[model samples]
Target: MRTYQLYLIDDEFASHYFGKERMVYQLFKDYKEAVGEYKKILEKQIDFILKPIQEIKIHQFISQYLQKNKDFYTNNGLYYLEIGKRSTAKLEIHERCLMLKANGNYEAETIFFEVLRKTESSFIAIDLEHQRCGWLKPIKERKFV
Candidate 1:
């Protein structure tokens, strides 16, 4: 028999070393139940990922998910928050800045990046504005669209 479990992944510290492993939290057996709880939790904060797991390891699952959805967050070439201003960096942002989503409509002070190519600690990201690629720490800000 197979069982399902849900994990609460912290989006804030997702890119730092050991962040993903340490942030995986909560366990639920039902997907719908978990989603319902996640929705309620989202009302209070946007920096949490509620992911459902079957058999795969948490780290593996998150890595695959981020790889698959890399395009969604990179459509507008991604943006770095500078006092709430949408700024594009030719390379990578040096200072810790919030990654903007919803095409800059929404902004959260969380680490968010689209993974083009990945390693254990970082990934290559494309700056569509400059048509250049640079290394960035990968972070999964959301579990779903």
Candidate 2:
């Protein structure tokens, strides 16, 4: 049986929940406490930390999964792939409209919209004069059409 572990960290507190085992481990009250527990676990279970599993953004997971694997409502269109050590891919403007048109799959659309909204919110939160006019302009201009 496949098992999954969910580590929740909020306000420096940490809690671990195991899906298959149906076990909850509240190991720490803060990051400091969590670090101590992690160190202790590291001595015995170093292999567990190196396991391969998908780490996804909560908002983008659904759309990403569907798009990549199932091709759910995804049309043949140009997409933007960020270049760097930590690269990211995003649908272009035409791709966005195609996704919007495919309302038949509401779940995928909903997830994509949520991801879009979050990205837009973060972009809007930036300092306009410094970030938008200076840094973002060149990046936006370089975007793939």
Please give, for residues 1-145, the per-residue lDDT of candidate 2 as tens digits: 1111222112111112212111112221222244576656743342232222222343254456445543333345433332332332334342111112222323433344445443332111111122211111111222377
Model 1, 1-145: lDDT tens per residue? 1111112223333344233332222111122245676756643342233212222332343346544432222223332233244422211222212222223322222223332122223332322333333334445544585
- Most accurate candidate by TM-score: 2
Question: Which pairs clash inside model 2?
Answer: none
Worst 10 residues of 2 by lDDT: 132-141
Q: Cα deviation in Å at residue 121, candidate 1?
A: 1.6
The residue pairs that clash in candidate 1, if any, are none
Query: Candidate 1 regions off by >4 Å?
Result: 1-102, 105-110, 114-119, 138-145
Evaluate model 1: give its lDDT: 0.30
lDDT of each: 0.30, 0.28
